[model samples]
Target: MSGNTGYAEIATFFRRQIADGTLAPGDSMPTQKQVRQQFGASITTVNRAFQMLKAEGLTAARVGQGTTVAERPRVAATATARLRRISRTGRAYGPKERSVDHQARLLSCADPDVAAELDIELHDEVLVRSRVYMKGNVRTIASFSFINPRGWAAVPESLSPEPLERFWQEDYKERTGRTTVKLPERRGARLAYPYELAMLKVDAPPNAAVPVLVLLNTWHDEDGPLEHWQDVFAPGLWDSDEE
Candidate 1:
């Protein structure tokens, strides 16, 4: 881990160890000197590896505390479970979690991403729902659901705080004269902004931001896109496959 890719290599080594439970939460990471000696890397290179882990919210560092694996809630619920529940019962969280708070309202579509996904013009009024899901006292994820234009008229319940299953079908058939299809989704990850971290109640010590998982789901039909939902999952949400 000492050449041009030393930083990335060292980072991935520790990342894998953490993922597989070789490094448990609250367990101290090897000191920078130890890492540099083991990897034959420069001090700067070793620091970069630690920085990557910190930014990802996988570890924490302090003057006396050094660096330790960050403690995280072990909620067994998966994203697929929540999606299935939403499709069947319109609930945001699966059986393993619960909605702690929810807010819903109609507003002009100010987000360009949402407009592109829903194939709608900017400034068009649409339904927006914000929710925070929790497992026991710990937050599991924070989500924002944007209902496309069709659901506004046909499924007025989209404006309510309550979750609605198949909110697009009644309107899809009326507009396209056909049944709706499946919900297309995409997942990604990026460093969370300061405000978002506060909203999700995350702490990223020694760094300004933490990593987050993003889920973008679309409910569309043969005619075109109908409704788009963006779910922002909080840090430390364990994916069984990844583990």
Candidate 2:
């Protein structure tokens, strides 16, 4: 495969192996060195393949354990499956409404992934929202968002648990006199740590990387800027645009 083809192919090859039952759960996969030998690809290419596998819930990596198969498959979500997914990056989808609590118990748990990069004490004050997204009866995705306290605190307490699209209708009007909630095109961001990967429920092969879309929103409060930040992601959903 061409270099540009490497990432997708690496993802597909392992997926095929699983579909064909050639690589079952708990089965060890070929090492990166071995895959490179077989495919004549670079270490980075192999790593990308591994990332695809992880994102698909095909494998897991541990320092001493190396990369091994995952016990269950990662459920790939359809575009329609993402109806309830929340983007922390303060972007709005459409106008809607709901009831929410003002002083919600937004807790910050201990995770090594976000610990060093952020001040957990600060995180303690950030808003936390969690929801499970589904398509029909099957659960497609589960998500949680952490908002910057300063800006999040400004949100009208009545809309606490509603989807961002619905929440922002009154959200914007209250924060700013304008009702328009426009956002820039998205630049994809990957969750930075293994703990974050766990939080996102992503699984991939050894050396697998997580690719996510992190949306950032700046809530305007009449006169000026409010530092509100939100993050949204569905770990293994919507890869090819086919679904």
Q: Which candidate is the best by TM-score?
A: 1
How many backbone collisions does model 2 have? 10
The window of 10 residues in a row where model 2 has the poorest summed lDDT is 91-100
Give candidate 2 misplaced runs (Cα > 4 Å).
Answer: 1-124, 137-165, 168-181, 191-196, 203-209, 213-218, 223-232, 239-243
lDDT of each: 0.70, 0.49
Score candidate 1 by lDDT. 0.70
What CA RMSD would candidate 1 show?
11.6
Error of 1 at 76 (Å): 5.8
* Backbone clash numbers for all candidates listed: 0, 10
lDDT of 1 by residue, 1-243 (tens): 555548888988887566545676778999999998888889999999999989877789867989998765664334454554455444444333567567788899887889888888998888888877775577866777777766667666667787555444565476657676557567889887675676678877756767777776777766677667666767877542222
Residue pairs of candidate 2 with colliding backbone atoms: 54-203, 54-204, 54-205, 88-230, 88-231, 88-232, 89-215, 89-216, 89-230, 100-158
**lDDT by residue (tens digit), candidate 2, 93-186:** 1112122222234666354333322334533544556554443333334344444444454565623565454553366466745543333423
